[model samples]
Target: MTDPDTAATDAHLLETLANLRWNRFHTIVVLLFGLGWALDAFEVTLIGNVLGALRQHFHLGSNAMSFILAAWFAGLMLGASGFGILSDRYGRRRVFLASLVLYGVATLATAFAPDLAALMVLRLIAGIGVGAEYAAINAAIAELVPSRSRGRASAIVLNFWPVGSFVAALLAWLVLSALPADLGWRVVFALGGAIALSAAWFRRHLPESPRWLIEAGRREDARVIIGRIAAGLTDATTLAPAPVVQRVRREVNGLRVLLRHYPGRLALGAVLDFAEASGYYGLFAFLPIVVLPALHLPPARLPLFYLAGSVGALIGGFAAASLLDRIGRGVTVAGFYLATALALIGFAAITGMGAGAIMLGFALVNLLATGSWIAAYPMFAELFPTSLRATGIGASVAVGRIGAALSPFLVGYVGARSMPAALVMLAGFWALGAVAVLVWRRRGGIEARGLALEQLAVEPARYV
Candidate 1:
């Protein structure tokens, strides 16, 4: 039995979702964001796909490889913190574009690393670019997309990440199969760097955010951009002329301001970050470990399983976009995380059973978990206002990176001690993440709605 108010709220959300559509600029922005996200994912996951080859080629041990992995995560943490502040102080577009170029170059440079130390440094630098991009891109999409479809749009955009990883997996299979031993991993790294350069060109055509422009006291320019966007609105029946928005300049007081004013938002952001980081690393980072064993497949078969997970992730991302408004961010996340927790547990159980069961569970785990994971990013991005959106997201990403950094270590530790227990423990992380979302809901509902971004522009002081 359902409550009337809940039912009415659900109905209204459905109606809102039905009416959701993005202008061309916004759509292009999301597509590019998706592509960039996918490329980033591909680059990061390439290491996992080539870890064995890297060790064999470089005469590296497992311990040394682990250190390299840590270096990458450390770079991510630094980049997230540094660029988050930069996004607020400078502007989203400049920082966003710069980070892309930096990462692209660093990724490409990996192909020529002379030693393990050199590889570590290059990967660390690449991690920073990757880390910085998350905040810039999430902030860009949140500010650009209409409020009614923000949640769904963000989710859909994020879904392309798995596609990138899937592509990497496919490439890994192809290279490992066909390429000469010494040149294979180099090709993978070079490709990551090359693809990242495309983000720069794509971003060039993107206009600076109108919301950001108004905030920075560039009203005239903001108006011009808005007019251009509105010019293409085929259905302008509900559209209004751009109003004169007063500028509200923001300061860059990195950590202190974030801690003092919006403590709850910061806390919520961290919780979401932890949940997302743990779940994502567990599923995608550990893909080769979990899926290959479960399927009893040879090493060559690993990419095919990874490809299946990527397909599931794409489905999840699109499904989230289609259903986010009707489901509401909190409800959708809570439901998704809860289901993911159960699926992870079920996956563990089925893995021990047999090959047929493992394949079925492998697909189902990713199918459920990936969708649930897709819903988190948009909702997480929305939790803070524009003033702290980048910073908050950056801080959250930093905190989340810690969890991600810890996962491989934990997985290794657990595998060393007991494999099944490690599997079950990952499931527990998902359950804890579900609890975090429920806690967030008890404090507040969805972060923004119905022109709230516009309203924030009206009274920027209210947000700060």
Candidate 2:
């Protein structure tokens, strides 16, 4: 147990860190971290764009392709769960760098895979790297940014995802238009890996989270980092001197702690994550197998559709960033969840329309889906205390990946029979998320908007 005096000191440090104004340092942190996240998006979009080429080269059917997608999601589940624990117990910066390097190297190697089995294994490894980033990056950003702007900051970082998607779409179009399918796909993966590796080098400059440091009983180290953050601020306020305390290390299982103490938050996060993941992944899966054939568009033109939808994603992400701090987390998140569900239904309804109508529907659905996740990521990070934040985020993502993993297969199975049915199934997932958020709010769950992490860290019962 923590000593009362030491706890007080820790509280003061946290308050000081949380109250700092946004600065160049914070901007740099967001950009670097956001770039890593964008790489995940780039990878996903790249694979989606190249699915036709992959299928032709490997002699695979729609079900086999879905299995490959499932393999990647399975790796994500394992990586998020395992790395979340490691980040909490060890440090965020190291894990952040390590995950990036692993992703970069694995993805680069994927370009050279000789057969179906090799490609599946490489994709799985790359998925593990990207999955680790999901936990570590979200937790680090939540702790590093000021509480007042945490929502917007996280949304802005998420905004980079669509940007990456846009770039991937554009690149896929350019490369595939100029080169052979087999060669173009390899080049895209290689470029993505090279970009990821370059970003990792720059991320070496990011500092460790002071909150995590203090939680680990490294008070002096936290103080030094905090001092550096405040050094160049024009309006910097002085914080209390660090209290001399021995390092008190506790050997506790983060997962067990979360299950025992914060079951509701865990369930809520998982539900929201599941809703967004299924909708998002299902859309990509449906596009290649269902939408392309329905529109009578060639495989090469699929990237153009993604390119168009990415514009909607950017707009939706920015809109979410603006509303999150103004409307509050509960309202913003639940509203987006409900809106996305409605949009998905509309998308399915418009499937019989011309290619122009389908394109418009695709953009609108991407917009709403982007909004849902932009608001949800920060909420997941804020739901738990510093000690278990990454673990909580990772566990939620792991559970969500179950939905993500199955979504493609669901689309392939149901979509083969009925496209509308598959889409409605995805819409149901979003509706479930909306209901879960409403239930949490009615039960007196924490609002979390503009509240310091320390303030939000109280027992769920206390909020009630």
Candidate 3:
């Protein structure tokens, strides 16, 4: 058992961390970890942008191409579940770094795929890397960042999703327009691989989460890491501190922990992800491709519209980042969902008002709906203990991938018949997600705004 003095000291350690000024190390963490999602967006967005080209090159129809999306999501679910457990059991730095390498190599190899089967296989491999990143990066940032700033820090980290998408759009537009059709798509994949590879080196300097180390009973090690990060603080002069008596629990299987012990969180995460993924993958990401057919827009000018939509995501993401700490998770999440649903309804309302109206609707949905992605990760990161953090988040993301995998097909089919109905269906997704979050909160989910992970960890213990 922890004595009062040691408990106070441990609390001081967290307080000291929470009070540290944002500096070079924090910037490095953001850039390195942020790149994980950026590369994922880049790769996935590239697939979306280049789908027409792939269809032409491989003689695939829309249905077959959709399976490619499904395959990627399948790999994502597998990697998120598998790697989440691995990272929790092994170590964050190793699992996340290796996931990046795996993504890079797979993406680079995708450039050389000789046939459709080979290409699909390569995409699945790349998706695993992307999928693993979601769990690893979120867990690391939540544990490492100061408690007071965890919301903004994590928000900034995840906001890279749009940046990645925008970069992909830019590359695809420039490359596909400038180079030979066959070679341009290959270059885009190569570009993603190279960026991911380059980012891995910088990750080496990142420290293990002090919280995780402490949970594992490595008190001295955790203390040293905290000392190093807080080196400039007036009191952290010691390389080693006296060991604190901590309550080190046996490692539980993370899956069992979520399924049996903290079932509400598991249910909340699954439902939240399912709704967000359905709308995001079904409509937002897939919208640009469908607009030409659904709204009678010119195919040649779609890139400009797509760029505008991507920019909206960035705007909304940053806005959410700023508000997350202020509004608290429950309000922010519930509000975003309700607003996103309304935006989708408005989008459906303008189905035949000409291309301009449709475009505007798309932009609004892009902006408001992005909150789902922006808020989801930070909230998931906050929900579990250090021991179960990665697993819980990974399982959440895995559930998300399942929803994402089916959404494109569902959206494609529905939109082809009636754009209005499709938009409303997407709205329904948002409502479902919002309801899940609100219900979960009522049933014992903590709001987790500015609290430290240590503080948040205590809440679920009561119910679990």
Candidate 4:
């Protein structure tokens, strides 16, 4: 149990942090954390770009390729589920740096893999690192940023994902054009490793989250970090002493607590995550097998399609960043999901048109789909308290990865029978997410707009 004095002090420190104006310190935190998302995107895009080369070099068949893909997602699920608990138990800074090193070293090793088995193992390890980043980065950013700008700040971090994807596509094109397929893919993996290591080095300078420190019963550490943050702000005027309500409670197992106390939130997060992952992954799966062939597009030109999709992702991310604070999280996320469903329907209807028309439809669907997740990520981080934030986020991400892993198979099975049915099935996933968010909102879910983390933790849910 928390001491009364410590609880009051924790409240005061949080209030101070929440009221501070944006400054250089917060900017650095966002940029550093954002790189994690970018690196994950780069790794994912690089793998997709190099699959044909890998298949050729290894002389592998369909089953082998499927297993390789499954290994990466499996690693992601395990990492997110395991490392999230570590982050909550140890500290965000330690797990953050360690996960980066693991991913960097594993990816670099992958570049030198002599056999198909070695390559698969390395990919799985690298994926674990990226999965760990999802939990750590989201929790850290939410705790560090002020309440008023948290939504936009988190959205901005998510925006870096598309930037990374675009860079990977561009890099793959240039490298493959200059080198042999075998050497080019190796170089791409090497570059990804170098970038991750570099980011990890810079991240050493980042301070531990004050909120986490306090929750861990380290008041002095929290105070020192809070002081350092305030010292960096130019408008660091003295904050008025705010009245503190005594709300401290005994610590318990986070997962158990989540099940007992926040079942509604856990369900909401899982449903939203599963919907987005399956729908987005399902669309990509359908495209390579069903849509591209119908459009008479060759596999060699897949990079161009990815580049177009990246542009749409960037546009959608920016739109989410702009709308999240103004329109509120629930409304913004639900709206984007609904828009994506409609866009998918339109895309399905236009599949028989010219290549340009089909690509345009594809980009439109990507735009709305990307926006949905960008808005939803902040919600995942905001729904839980500091003590369990990473765990909660990790659990949701793991659940989502399960959906991601199965989406391709579902799409393949359904698409093999009927193209329109596959597209409609993806649309149904998005619609389910939209309905879930709307129901949560109607049933008094927390909005989390311009509210401090402490306030959100203690306040009763109400219509926003």
Best by lDDT: 2
Off by over 4 Å in 3: 1-12, 232-252, 293-302, 459-464
* Stretches of candidate 2 exceeding 4 Å from the true structure: 232-252, 462-464
| Candidate 4 Cα misplacement greater than 4 A, ranges | 59-63, 233-252, 289-299, 459-464
Pick out the ten consecutive residues of candidate 1 with the lowest summed lDDT. Answer: 234-243
Tell me which of candidates 2 and 3 scores higher on lDDT.
Answer: 2
Query: What TM-score does prediction 1 earn?
Result: 0.85
Q: Is candidate 1 or candidate 2 better by TM-score?
A: 2
Cα error, residue 176 of model 3, in Å, equals: 0.8
lDDT by residue for model 3 (347-425), tens: 8888788777776777778888786768877986787878888889899989888889988788778777887888898
Q: For residues 1-464, could you state the per-residue lDDT of candidate 1 as single tens digits?
A: 55787546433432332244667766777787888888888877787777656766887654565667778888888898789877766667777888889999999999888888899999999999999988888888887776777777788778887788789989987887688646888888888888899777776666666666555545555556566665533211222332223211335564666677666667767776777677667555454444444344555555666667667767766777676777577777778888878887777765567656655666677776777767777776765666667888899889988887787677666644555666677788778878887876676544443434433323223222
Cα lDDT tens digits for candidate 2, 1-464: 88999989988898889998888778877888889888889987888888877876787788888988998998889889889877887778778999999989988998898888998999999989988988999999999888899999998998899999999999988988888888888898899999999999888878778998897777877877777776632222233432323211342477887777888888888888988888889888888867776666766788988998899999999999999999999999999999999998988897777778777888999998998998998887788888889889999999889999999999988988888888898899899889989999998888988899988778767323
RMSD per model, one decimal: 7.7, 3.5, 3.9, 4.8
Give candidate 4's total backbone clashes: 0
TM-score of 4: 0.92
- In the predicted model 1, the residue pairs found to clash are none
Per-prediction TM-score: 0.85, 0.95, 0.91, 0.92
